[model samples]
Target: MVDEASKDGLNALAQAAKQAPRDSPRDSTRRGLPPVHLWNPDHCGEIDIVIRRDGVWMHEGSPIARKELVRLFSTVLRKDPDGYHLVTPVEKLRIRVDDLPFRAVSLGREGDDLIFVTDVGDEVRAGPDDPIMVQTDPITGEPAPRIHVRRDLWARIARPVFYELVEMAEEVDGQLVVRSGGQAFPLGAVA
Candidate 1:
């Protein structure tokens, strides 16, 4: 498998992506963010987090510095408040708690819609005209939360990222049925 990130030629589009395209009609709702490609030059030195719904995707205007993105996301996950929501182009991610090294993709904007790519390079993309729903970890059963974390002896990290995700997953049923929130979804389905 390719390295998680190997954007060898993605930097070339950074300058062009700096501003929203002049040709398209801007959506009043999007607040004037431009659509960038799968890879953009400006993001080369940045530590960005891609929402991992389908696979890998980037937000239209969320161009933060590399480390800042990690810090912000880390802090949010640590807070782990009830009813917390992380809205991306494709879905809204929310949960009571989350561990780190969480695998995900961003909601990359194409025209008016959003897309996602996974760590292993699978994509989940849908048209902007259509609505998509991704939900937070919901409480399923009354069982005590079970936390399972795998330690890597050789691969050291500041803290294990997957541990947080595992913690969040422990609170729910394996089925994880989420109520549908959009036209593309149906009732009581697993997201």
Candidate 2:
């Protein structure tokens, strides 16, 4: 159950997120991301926000249904030593993340670069700066692939997107690899 203070905090966060200044349009790809890394506000406290493994943002035990609101809040998201937090110029509140905060829902190719679209609308290009990494579950041996989205933030590649990548992979030195931004990323050992 959520306490009254928690509820108030959540409401304040939502309001602050909505009221935050946005100079650029809502296009994640074309506009510049908010400079959340530079903000060092005092840690206000914890808020009842959870980003599920499936990339759904939950607040006070309910899913936040507004897509625009989700996108807006995502701009202020930052990962610190303690955990993920929603940061602004004045306040910073820790939030729980079950897994990575974003999901790579779509993949496309632009010349030699592989561009990924995250569930929240950020477009990231895989390259030396933002490389792709895959980890196999020790117990299940299932491949879990992720792509670097921004500073200390990564997006889990969805199963379907991973499959698409596999279909585009090429055999390179006994490994299935994909090239993007002039770099080769290994999918796995050729099987």
Reference-based lDDT, each prediction: 0.28, 0.88
| Model 1 score (lDDT) | 0.28
- Most accurate candidate by TM-score: 2
RMSD of each: 16.5, 2.6
The candidate that wins on lDDT is 2
Q: Tens-digit lDDT track for model 1 on 16-52?
A: 2333242244543322333322112221232233433
lDDT, candidate 2, 18-116, per-residue tens: 666653676554466667777788999887789998999998888988888789888889999999999877899999999899999999999989999
- Candidate 2 off by > 4 Å: 1-8, 18-30
Which run of 10 residues does model 2 get worst, by summed lDDT? Answer: 22-31
> Model 1 segments beyond 4 Å from truth?
1-8, 19-26, 35-185, 189-191
Clashing pairs in 2: none
TM-score of each: 0.22, 0.89
